[model samples]
Target: MKPLERLGEAKTPDGTVLQLYRHDGAYLIRADGVELMSTRRHLSEDKLAEVACAPLVTKPKARVLIGGLGLGFTLREALRHLGPDAEVVVAELVAEVIQWNANPEYALSAEAMADPRVRIVHEDVSKVLRNNVGGFHAIMLDTDNGPEGMIMKENSRLYATRGIAATMAALKPEGTIAYWSVGDDPGFVRALENAGLEVKAMKVRAHATSGPFHTLYIAS
Candidate 1:
């Protein structure tokens, strides 16, 4: 069997190490020795985009914001769902992650990044949400490991009440937001409901047929 090779790494705002790895044909990213995401199992990520952008498939000139760019699966799935006239703004905090996807040797997201309708922003998603009031027809948040902060300490705020509020404000009146979580986070659901959003928690597999169940929270 081939051994896993460390490709590259970067540091988070809290000084946590984010490492990228490859084994066989799969890519994996770890935060402080914990698995953050992998190309081998990204059905949940694809679902996050499908649920968030499905409503806007026919909406002309629709705009959407994606909070993370894990292997660009969500972005690719979103581009597949939205119309050609729609625009997708991806806000990724870690520059290395973006770089890894752009590097042809890694073969990650270079094609998705080249999409004319897609715009890449190298900034924290929280700040993006704060600045874009009613700016997106849909919002997708797949940062950190669910509502908990695994990659960066500051990412927790993206799931907090304040962060949820910012997402609400950033969305158009009929817009929807989807959150990807590694597990069920009941408390986070309460916070979304408290914000007056009708929440739908969908259990999705990490892989298409089988894998640990991940939660996809759709709120509007």
Candidate 2:
């Protein structure tokens, strides 16, 4: 069957969505109710989750920061791994995205907004990190497309030397920072080292499929 198409969406006290669209069998997230993500790839949710928390050996009793909620995949993974003492702070710049998760009428985020462990802040994550009062045990940024970014151009700052320094300061000693990338970025690895964090950079497929690859940075 063809999926749902051109349904209208919007931002209330929640987050943003002009609309959504159905292409083939997949519904996409659209600015004017158009589609930007898909259900066909929902199979990858568990994979993204695995990568989000792969750095932790035992369950972590600490704090976590998840940059963006792209389809809520990584957040789901992070919550699954953290121990009961853990808390997740999500700083999403697009207020609409936060609203998207709460719009029960359309079900944009599929209940991610309701997770007890998650605290959604409708502000820019960079500012939150720089001004943050406390530190985290694991900081995972599924934000940006790696060195490349998907949303705002200003996001490039998050991968810079100064940005890495801010991130490092937000972490506890031996804390882990995990970043998801659309591709590999040697420059980011260098920046992480400059920040004085031991780093691991590796490539992993988006899902079990060998095709459609992506990269990850695990630093501490």
lDDT of 2 by residue, 1-220 (tens): 6655654455432233345554664455554333334554433444445655665536556677888765676777777776666688888766555665667765455576677777888776788788873577777776645566444455678888777878878877777778877777777777778777787766666556655667777787
Among all windows of ten consecutive residues in candidate 1, which has the lowest summed lDDT?
Answer: 145-154
Clashes per candidate (backbone, < 3 Å)? 0, 19
Instruction: For candidate 1, report its TM-score.
Output: 0.97
How many Å off is the CA of 11 in candidate 1?
0.3
Model 2's alpha-carbon lDDT is 0.66
Q: List ranges where model 2 is wrong by over 4 Å.
A: 1-4, 7-25, 30-39, 42-60, 105-110, 149-151
Per-residue lDDT of model 1, residues 1-220, tens digit only: 9999999989988898999999999999999899988999999999999988887899999999999887899999999999999999999999999999988888699988999999999999999999999999999999888885355787898888899999999999899999999898899999999999999999999998888999999999
In candidate 1, which residue pairs get closer than 3 Å at backbone N, Cα or C atoms, i.e. clash? Answer: none
TM-scores for every candidate against the unseen true structure: 0.97, 0.79
Per-residue lDDT, model 1, residue 215, is 93
Residue 105, candidate 2: C-alpha displacement in angstroms: 4.1
